[model samples]
Target chain A: MKEVRVFAPATVANVAVGFDILGFAINRPGDEIVARLNPDITGLKIVAITGTGDKILPTEVLENTAGVAAYTLLKHLGKEDLGIELEVHKKMPFGSGLGSSAASAAGAVVAVNELLGAPLSRESLLYFSVLGEEVADGSFHADNVAPSLVGGITLIRSNESLDIHHLPVPQNLQVAVVHPDIEILTRDARAVLSDTISLKKAIRQTGSLASFITALYTNDLPLLGRSLEDHIVEPQRKQLIKGFDDVKKAALECGALGCSISGAGPSVFALCDSGYLAQAAGQGMQEAFALHGVNSQLYVSPINQDGVVIL
Target chain B: MKEVRVFAPATVANVAVGFDILGFAINRPGDEIVARLNPDITGLKIVAITGTGDKILPTEVLENTAGVAAYTLLKHLGKEDLGIELEVHKKMPFGSGLGSSAASAAGAVVAVNELLGAPLSRESLLYFSVLGEEVADGSFHADNVAPSLVGGITLIRSNESLDIHHLPVPQNLQVAVVHPDIEILTRDARAVLSDTISLKKAIRQTGSLASFITALYTNDLPLLGRSLEDHIVEPQRKQLIKGFDDVKKAALECGALGCSISGAGPSVFALCDSGYLAQAAGQGMQEAFALHGVNSQLYVSPINQDGVVIL
Candidate 1:
């Protein structure tokens, strides 16, 4: 194939109870990457960028997420000598905490792999994608990258070892996400957190996470809602996002099973049992954010089964 | 149903990553309780105590676990005026960290319910059992009581609300328990713990627990072994049990899937894929304890499905 284009879905990290450890993919508001053979150029290059509009994303091969991901994969395949050019199309808002950078990195690797006739397995490509995404936050966490690259609900048992596991998604599970017209840097979101937490809180978090996993396996929606509580991270980070409490309350009252900040937000997410309820929750969240004088974009989607896919 | 005898299986609480939140029942070395309707008495009474040599247990209705459980059930049923006598049989060692007190309470409640024509559902009985067991350690934790009452693996989401959930057990899963000839009180073990813990450790613990639950649902034995790690409670409590480190190492070396302190200390438990491996691990653990100049008792069995049963 001379050229390939892929869409990498955005992801919701933390998932209310699984801070830095769990995430799930959504179908829309992702990034698109186009990889083509450039016989004139010897290594990878970022030829064009679109859809980001004055955001001034990095374009250098070593600095750009898409560039780095494609470059890393090419290097691993001993194909660095191959001529290739990548065009990044950022469909999602930057710093919205919906895994915008992860979509870029994931899409790049997937497009490049398809252009090369798929030399590597999907699992093998995750390492390069995670490394590329790490440049955005300077952390090796894969809660966002894993789900954006592999889809469905993902669990990272050990970020150091990149031990990723895919959890079963209930058939009726849907998500409602509202990205406010504001940016909250991942570094700033992380800074609000404390180094130490009460042991009691830690146990409670573990119980919630454990129960959440069980709920997924058993298809117990009520249990999932009850378990989707964050005792450690969310409390500290929610203050950074405007109208978080009101938005969450609105979503829950609108029939969301659970609601919390998505990733390092300005973006808040709600999980619902049906598409209709997800849409209702999304509108509720948007209205709640607007009440705080914050404009927001809403997206309602079922759990994405495919992560990055060829267009 | 004038007189009823019931046996309550012993339980292993904590389960490595789920301190005060998760546990499972085992087949043998449980307390047996016999509840008889008495015409002469007008309230719950403890008439006989056996199987505990040189270890004096409380016989008073409020102080004794069995008596408390029976009295609580009777009171809840508006049958406080009914005549009843309970026989307390302690088959398991006290302060062994094997849910000895929980077994007594669970057996007492089950026997009393049976003698009263089983008016209360098993779910409703958990409250009385937990209250009865709470007197032993003065904490409202139900990790032990829930499993002993409901059987299989149980997760207590909230001790305050008495929220309990039963988890699925793999068919081939086996347990090996080694009680070193020593006793470590739960209160003392809890005393040595820090009220606060590092956030990094807490996240790691949640990841392990989530992975463990996934492993159970998927029937992934190797993943279960990898996730059966305790970061916060095990390290501090292991010091209270002599030869703990060596015993755990021995169990792992003997084909055990995972090994850790059973509940608090002194007694240790190992999980294995088959009965043979569990038996081997039990012997290895017993031998390791013996090398530390501590004689130990060993029990190996499959995951018990039936908790308290009629005798």
Candidate 2:
């Protein structure tokens, strides 16, 4: 119970068709981190947080997701004197719609649980990251966190009870991640959405959401592409992301199953049949963003099946 | 080919939360028909039509869904001289949420296709049935026909290419069907609906639709229950189906996963985990309907994975 390694997988939350209710965990490799039971006198502290720098905020239980997760563990186990430190490999980029913060929180919790003989159930431990999410985004939504903690696709469903489910990830499915060098804070991105949308539009949105999930389980690529439509949020948020339409069109033309803004914005994710097509879609998307004077790194990988794992 | 036996599975269309886009084939047995090839000279001639004569229209190209399907296939194959004699055995009750007509239409087309050596893929053959639905419902919708033909769950994404898919059915699932004697025509059921719904209401509808599909994939029953809500159509339509609220509440009280009007329905569907619970839900629903002076027949069955098949 001295040292442990837990990997948190990246996730796609608010997948185009299902805004808050749908999410999937990519089988692609994600952030890896090591958490150790340090014999320090600090009340939940990080010795040296790797990957992200000064912008990651003060490593205090109040501001840090990993710190919060550790604090929660200590509080639950009635071990206030115990100190823990997390070293995130940051394999998945932070703020890339890949549940970056959730990774930190989930990785911390999983590591601590492993270090302490794993007492809590997987769903029981997921709340720590969800609480941490409330710290940054006023609301505790777990579309990204749940999937990041437990691999495969996860759905937030109702905010109550924090239902976490790990769905099946179809084989050979690849997802292309393109992170544009732009930032649309989750809070800001959320604020732009309309409080009330037309019912016709809503039903159609429901249709698309149903179609998308159906397509995923049935492996209907074309249906998945068509189902990745957001009549409610995308229209309002697309203006926030420069050249979203052109980029999406480019991805589709390049054989991407579908393309949409990942999470709140800036980063875009596209589903493709093969790694080559995914890579092409990613590069094409990056180039389209360049047309709008935006440059970003492209992460071309397969779907992340092994959600959170220890390296 | 002298004899052709084709199968179309029973489908749950207007899937509680998903009005139009979501549908799934039940695990129970469905419709089956045998169409023997007969050489004739003129337009589609249904040499024989039997089973559920009360609901089925005569062999008219514009009225009978079966005739329409046969005609569509004959036109596509460019063999107007091909005579088809379809013998349909209706396993599902007419006017039930289960796609009874769609089953017949899909079965007929598939049987004909087999008799003709199946020149069209399953996806292409679905169009013939979908085209035939226009004869029954006055609109070309594929939600019912798609699942009946493809098996599993289906999503009618678009009419252009007839986007349909068979999604994965959740593990440990069963469905309870309750049909009231009071007749509810599809046209009348649609008549009660408000033509235009608010944008916010629309998004909520989409959320529910997303919720049902998400719940199915993740196997989150509670989430699925939460998502079994309708904002636009159900509210208005419920006024016509007496004891709707009471029956729905009774079914839910009896551990029913979710309950709603099945397709422009007077018939209601309740999903349950066990066959006993399913039967209980149906009986409880009947008792609830009795309070409103409406008598109903309840069918407790599992998800019919096998679509239409030959007898």
Residue-wise C-alpha lDDT for candidate 2, range A1-311, written one tens digit per residue:
37898778777787787676567676554666677777755555666666664456556666777777767776888875676666656665665666777777777778778877888877788888777666656677787777777766665545566754455555556888888877777777877877666655765777677776666676766667777788777889888888889999889888898888888866889988788889899889888889989888787876666667766
lDDT by residue (tens digit), candidate 1, B130-237:
899988878888999998998999999889888788888987999999989987877799899999999899889888988999898889999999999999899988
Q: CA shift at A60, candidate 1, in angstroms? A: 1.5
Could you tell me how far off, in angstroms, the CA of residue B202 lies in candidate 2 after the best superposition? 7.7
CAPRI band of model 1? high
Per-residue C-alpha lDDT of model 2 across residues B1-311, encoded as one tens digit per residue: 38887667767787767677777776554677778866653445665555665765566655778778877887889975666666667766776656778887888888888778888877788888888877777888888888887776776666566766566677667787777877777888777776666654664565567667767777777777777777677788888788899999999999888888877777788888778888888889999999999877666676776665544
> RMSD in Å for candidate 2, one decimal?
4.9
Docking class of 2: acceptable
- Candidate 1 regions exceeding 4 Å error are none
For TM-score, the strongest prediction is: 1
- Give the distance in Å from residue B121's predicted Cα in candidate 2 to where it truly belongs: 6.7
Reported per model, the fraction of native interface contacts reproduced equals: 0.87, 0.51
Candidate 1 chain A: minimum summed lDDT over ten consecutive residues — where? A202-211
